[model samples]
Target: MKRQHVIGMFDSGVGGLTVMKEILEQIPELRIIYLGDTARVPYGNRSKEELIDFGEEIITFLISQGAEAVVVACNTSSANALPDLKKSFDIPLIGTIEPGARLAVSKTSGGKIGLIATEATVRSKAYSSAISRVLSKGVLPEDQGLRESWQQGEQSIALVKSQACPLFVPLVEAGLSKTPEARGIARTYLSGFDTAGVDALILGCTHYPFLAPVIRDILGEQTALIDPAQAMVDELKSVLDKLDEVQEMKAKSTVKETWKLRFYVSGDPELFQSVGNTLLPGLIQEVRQVIWGD
Candidate 1:
């Protein structure tokens, strides 16, 4: 495999592992190098400048390791630092927002989509802007799912109801996603989308999938829950196809000769291993500790 086929992914912490799982499952033949800035733990409260600096560091580190394509797996980083990173990096750098937005726009039938993410993601309006950009493409029929129209050089977007589920991340990290308290918290946070009658809901935070069952039960069975990871993986696949990087698909075990996964974290490897085992068994057995500079 060429160096261009290897993807380097980074996040504030283990949350990005969700995206990694999707990438591994969907594009099993692709090589991946993952880094988690665990010492920083949460980037949700950081400023945009800090996010950009941190993202630049990770991107540089990844490139030095021979990663040709960089993926920002953290929603917070994707929302805040992606634009600058794209401009600064020579490689084709991708984030999670646009793909998720496009998917949600196409999936919403009632012309109303709800978003649940961290406070930083909500404040950044990355999803809101991406959804608007997609809706701005053109007007479509009811079957096409949007009631939007393009007129006077502007495109009207469907209703977007976004909420900051800041508490969701910490709970997931603490392994309380299936608890009664978690359900109560999810119920309190998600009732607005249920009331808005949103046909599709975006899991804007990478960490939000752990709470999927609670979210689905509260939002009812009809609402389409959109996870950006799969969409991001699809976007990556498209990039590889366009770049002539993808060879052929094969069974995961069969592709082991060419496929590889390496993990690094800025904090305790044991903690990463312990928590990651619950997410993906045997995937976290060996993680190298990556210091800030190294």
Candidate 2:
């Protein structure tokens, strides 16, 4: 008679669906509750205070609806509000930046990485800070001496160059991911990475993955694209392993086969469902709309 373990996730719009897709692929046994704050879509230009307020409301709502742990799937919110939100919440709160940074550092061959995200995220410099923290951990005493031998502009560890692509979210939401207009914008936003010579590019925003084709054509096939969703899911798996409820649920064979998913949006549910199905293809069903302050 134990309850199902529910993990809640939220993003500004349909972007977090990418992370949910990864979670479903890796750990399909856990029930999931996803919220898309489409009424406040494109949080890229919002202030940190506003982001924090939005996150508080969303997480509180999710927790009230049986979420045990929550994932901040929007890069802007993760960059600006994650620390504060984590402190405020009692349950485990995960963000995409640290996991993405760790994975990007491991994938880079030349210790050079690129990041493309929303304006608020790039402005916060969270990815840059996270990358430095990840790289610093692996640096040895001997590496300090080798730093002097590095080229005029390169570092001995990882170098992260981040750009904010504000239009990407709208493009993906509008289902224009593969259009010529999308390619044009991708080239405009990603032109610097071509000259920066980044061997690995972290798709810093969850929505950016939908435009991966446009990005690859602009950056060329040699550059490795890092999707943080995979790393985030890996982290979620480890977190779930430690939870008593998850452990208890896993002990029952019937529970393992009875996982469920629910979708809630603060804006037009029909539009959210349409775009979600496009990104995930028939995976989304019965999206419910919830108004704020309801």
Error of 2 at 235 (Å): 0.9
Give the clash total for candidate 1: 0
Model 2 over residues 191-274: C-alpha lDDT tens digits? 888788788899989999999888888887789899999889888876786675656666754335453999999999999989
Give the distance in Å from residue 208's predicted Cα in candidate 2 to where it truly belongs: 0.4
Candidate 2 is scored at a TM of 0.89
Which lDDT tens digits does candidate 1 get at residues 129-223? 88877666642424332443333334444546888887887787666778999999999998778677788898988888878889888888899
Q: Candidate 2 overall Cα lDDT vs. reference?
A: 0.85
Please give each candidate's TM-score: 0.88, 0.89
Error of 1 at 1 (Å): 10
Quote model 1's TM-score.
Answer: 0.88
